[model samples]
Target: MPTQGLEKSYSREHIARQVQRLGEEISRDYAGEELLVVCVLKGAFLFFADLVRAISLPVNVDFVRVASYGPHTQTTGLVEFRKDLEMSVTGRHVLIIDDILDSGFTLEALYQKLAGRKPESLKTCVLLDKRQARQTAFEADYVGISFDSGFVVGYGLDYQESFRSLADIYLFDPAQSV
Candidate 1:
């Protein structure tokens, strides 16, 4: 790990405060509607856990695993569903939670797929948005941080399935590429 490639981007406290704000926003907006918290698995596990708990209202939680990045840092723009949601999202306010929105492929594809299900409402929530890495067209409905695009890892983001244990987000050095 090259210390030079690393940059302190989001601290744990900063991330938490933003999450709290996001929760409050949701609390106010969907005051009466029943909510479904859909956690995109793997990367979103940590963020999802924190977010659902921070929320003040009752929420139905479910985990769905999807894959677009396979053995690569860059996305192929193909989204695949490895696991589907176990709960019914037929007619409820659903929130799609994700860790980072790097390329538009995953989220956009998901939105399209879920849209066909006819949910009462569908919205997105991302912890970090690499607003620059987008190639296709997609945007997060609620974003915690708008960060410069970079190979960032930590919090819930990982590199080669490593560094998921770091409490804060750190940048990745391109020089470390194999």
Candidate 2:
């Protein structure tokens, strides 16, 4: 349990196991389909790298850079694209991989943008689902774990651009965040 300082809740091995299971599920579901993995970059980078290799089927990986947080501790409810995908995404099976689903604003916004491209199917996968007041109706097709906590900073999640390198998932101090 996290308290004063950042503390581990799940180890790296545990995360790897969960990701392997997710890969199996994806392989089973989309066996013969055209699969394109859209990795939301910065945080999702680490998990995306691990997950794709675990899948037994052929898949293509693309990346999109989105930003909502500035120097603050919470989301600004706004998504700005730092980078976009190169693929057309027209009539192809698209799988969006995000590091976490916090308030859902960023993911929802991304989903809407991707929807405009008209894919054959759009599925979202998340590493962590932070139990908060999410404003979107969009649900994650694949979820690693759920947690009710303050801002976490590990396993690609961070605070003020730090702590993303930790292999374990951890909760940062509530008082330390803005």
- Against the reference, the lDDT scores of all candidates come to 0.85, 0.86
Candidate 2 Cα RMSD (Å) = 2.7
Estimated TM-score for each candidate: 0.93, 0.92
Residue lDDT tens for model 1, 1-178: 3334568788899989998999998888889778999999789888888888888898999888888888678887778999998888889899999998988889888888888999999999999999789887799898888887788888888877876777788887657655
Cα lDDT tens digits for candidate 2, 1-178 = 2234666788899999999999999999999876999999899999999999987888989999998987777889888999999988999999999999888889988998998999999999998888764667667899998887667778887777788888898877757544
lDDT at 34, model 2: 62
- lDDT score for candidate 2 against the true structure: 0.86
Count clashes in each candidate, considering only residues at least 3 apart in sequence or on different chains.
0, 0
Show model 2 residue runs off by greater than 4 Å: 1-4, 174-178
